[model samples]
Target: MSPQKWDENHPARILLLKEMNEGRIPLDSNEMGPAEVYYKYHSTVEFQVEGMEYNSTFTSRLRRLREQIRRDQGKPEKATKTKTARKKKDVSLTWNENHPARILLYKEIAEGRIPLDEKEMGPAEVWCTYHDTLEFQMDGVEFNDNFATRLSSLRAIVKRDQGRAANDRKALEKAMKNHPVQELNHRGEPQWNGSLAQALLQQDMAEGKHETMRPSELWEARPEYKEAFSRKDDFRWKIRQEIRTKKYLYTLEYRAEEKLRKNLKKEGIVLPDQDEDLDGVMDLEEMEDT
Candidate 1:
């Protein structure tokens, strides 16, 4: 009947009345109650709104908001399901035997892809220890000579777990591949024919010279020879020989010797017979005669 001012609360009602005057309202609502009028006007307001794109966009946004709420509530359930699936996968792939590669193989078996015999898996503790050992050796901060041996052992264990013949020979070969072949003489003693021998000979010659010369005369006449003679024991033929030979000896023996020395000193025992009588120890004449 009259134009209305734009009131935010009654915009929809105002729009409904305008549409009705324009003959666009879906139904005649003059007979409706106040509450019924509001409902009917609201429905007509929505219907009269132009553009399908705007309506579709609003519907889509509402749907997205509902999905976000559902996802938030379902997070724990989804996470639990995921964790269970991972655990099942791990169980299927684990190895059972006490092989060197048992830990790695067990992991593979847990995946269910590698079929392993139930009897083959050793004690769980042993498997765990072996796994830890391999991990330590492979990932240690400092590399050691024992790494090759440990790796070889791991490969052998893996082969055993798989029911395959252990390739120890190949493993050993591979392990030793990177190690330098120690240069040794005919008697398996390290070669000492370089500067070591020269240093020894020079000292011996200087010592022989010093035996016949006075200290003052020696110092004044040949200062260099005096200096060399002073270092005689430090560059002795016997000590050089020991160094060359000891290089090829078992490392455990050297460690044991050091430990013994340390323990002896700790117990206040002086190490007896520190020096060897070379002439008595090695009878060169007898060897020559023989």
Candidate 2:
């Protein structure tokens, strides 16, 4: 990869901020001006703004950036209630960039060697495939059981993040429908509430905010509905469903492990002695915790 060049579009300010956040630039930046701090750590990094001389303009530019950061930090809670939606952070940022396994995993992903689609293969399967790759061997990265766990975690984070935007959009739409920005009509005339707004507000306060539901009212209205849901079968069915899911997951993990073991054996890597199999080590209490 070519060394990154900083200009007007991609300022050294961004890199400076990132380094500060990650504790890489641990200098007392507030005391020392941005220019001094930047030059201290990133002395070799030549940053220049368009049509602006670096010696004269860079300090002023950094001052503006700092002021902007301060303004953002000092923003009031109510200031965020504006119609404009905030930018969401990328889901990939949740993973540690410096992680040995993740660095290789992301490289493979970028190279189109490893697909990010978890629907096609499980996390363990992905790790097993990743293990046998030339990139993994060339990097001299050793096997770790937690690689599979991290893959699963990252997949879950991505899935959850993907759903969040849709959920936010739905919520915004619902909110717009319920309480519009302009309550007045096209003619700028006062609209009739008909006590609906107040009633809705009261209902929201009770049900949504406080979660105060009237079970007795529902039971009286539909006795069968309550009886059906309250049955022991419903509770037992959930437990059975969870058991099935765990069993399926364990099976996938076992197969992935077996495949990895065989690959390692082929590569002349010593296999670690295992005291027990997955089934033998399965704890009822641990299953319940899940």
TM-score of 1: 0.15
TM-score of each: 0.15, 0.23
Per-residue accuracy of model 1 over 1-290 as CA lDDT, tens digit each: 34333243345434544544454532322222122223334344443443312222433433343344446545322323355334533442221232224344445554533334434543342334443322222112123344334334544555575553346666767877976455664545444445344454446444664446443443445444334334444334444344334333434344444454443332222233354333323233533433
lDDT of 1: 0.39
Off by over 4 Å in 2: 1-228, 280-290
C-alpha positional error of residue 83 in candidate 2 after TM-score superposition, expressed in Å:
74
lDDT of 2: 0.48
**RMSD to truth, every model:** 32.9, 23.6
**Residue range 76-105, candidate 2, lDDT tens digits:** 323342232222111112236544356567
Which 10-residue window in model 2 sums to the lowest lDDT? Answer: 84-93
